[model samples]
Target: MKTALQMSLAAAASLSVFTATAAHAHVSVSGPAFAGATHEATFGVGHGCDGADTYRVKVQIPAGVTSVRPLDSTFGKAVLEKNAEGNVTAVVWTKPLADVLPADTNYYKLALRFKVPDAPFTTLYFPTTQTCRSEAGVETTVAWSDTSGEHGSHDADAGTPATSPAPSLFILPARSPGWNKYTVNQHVHDLSVFNDALIVWAGKAAYSANPATQSLITTEPDTEVLSEIHPGTEIWVKY
Candidate 1:
């Protein structure tokens, strides 16, 4: 019962909302974001291309990252592409069989661990391509390879293609002790091997690891002695 003008305006509003959602749904890489450290990068894929099923995801490794090892995924098989210098340059995870995955499966989370170079305060971009296959075997590729200006700014703009934004990680500066520091997203267990003289900063309080006791002891007696540090805890160790 709406007028033609009203209907056009409603459709435009819906389209704008859809575009904003799509722009924010681009593949993203997240991790400790520290330089000179071994970082586990998690590549998040929110959805597949349109209504298609994502069959494969390929991520290009930027320069200065080495010893790339893709984590195992229940949804797909991981493959590595090595350069002539025997260094990994890219990693691809492909579904072994379409029937093995759920019919409604669209989202994927892939991870890889690599050593970030000593370049501090730098942003690393991983250009990724997602291959979506329809039921009829039609393949569609969405490239997430834009590293211009600010992250997601270009894609969020109107008229930009959906799913053409690259995943980026902000490398933080290296800490002292000639060892890099990393802030994990969750509490870390099993710090037995790291029994050396290391420092852990939880909030404003600092705790040092006692090599003899293999425990983290607080500098201040009143401060809490932590067995397991919570998320956002920064630790500096000599690697």
Candidate 2:
């Protein structure tokens, strides 16, 4: 009773539903977006290789980031990386958790200290990974990709079978937190610790939204800056 295109869109929509049900498939960052503000970036875990327990995470801080630090927890460890320019630096840090990734739940948190730049516009990238103790804690890398500036594309699950082309995940844009201050809280969700920003790509422009709205925020960036948030550049996680 439906045309091929209609059936295809229906399938795509179905896949999106399936992915949301498996919300813990990837690790992400979220929180408020004010400079010198510390927020919690939550790393989610679900449906990965069976027996795979998320152990360590590495977050790459983009240029123009300031006052970056990880919170101390049962699974907290981190370090800072200074840039060649000296003024700019990326926070290359990792942490160990008390609990491993649960079989059917999202678990993890990280306390992060971050200051937005002076500029009104900028991009932040976060490249992260999860390790399973079974492989001597072999790190399973989680790649970051963003639509150039397009909005609302990641309507499907990462593990779902594709019947059509998938919408790309795009990194959002953020503004500098000049003199303003925000607070970071530590809480356990599902089974993982999370402490970071939630970056949302709503449309042509990217903006960091509150992680609480992760369900509403879109991850598709515009097509122009397709590779701007490439996996290797470090994922600047902000919500």
Top TM-score hit: 1
Worst 10 residues of 2 by lDDT: 186-195
- Please give the range of 10 consecutive residues that has the lowest summed lDDT in model 1: 14-23
Off by over 4 Å in 1: 1-25, 100-105, 152-163, 176-239
Error of 2 at 105 (Å): 6.4
Candidate 1 per-residue C-alpha lDDT over 1-239 given as tens digits, one digit per residue, 9 for 90 to 100: 12432343334333321011122336877743656889888888888876777888999999999889999787687899988999898999988754433343656889999999876534577989988887777788988887654553321232443346678775555555434566644434423223332434444444333332213233334445444555566754432
The residue-by-residue lDDT of candidate 2 on 1-239, one tens digit each, is 11432343334333331012111225445532433334344434333445565555555565566666566555555665666666434333344444554442345565465665443222244544444443445546443333232112222232343332212212223333221222212111111111122232212432222332332223323312111222223223322
TM-score of 2: 0.42
Error of 2 at 119 (Å): 3.8
Q: How accurate locally, in lDDT, is each candidate?
A: 0.62, 0.36
Q: Which residue segments of model 2 deviate by more than 4 Å?
A: 1-25, 35-50, 84-106, 121-123, 135-139, 145-239
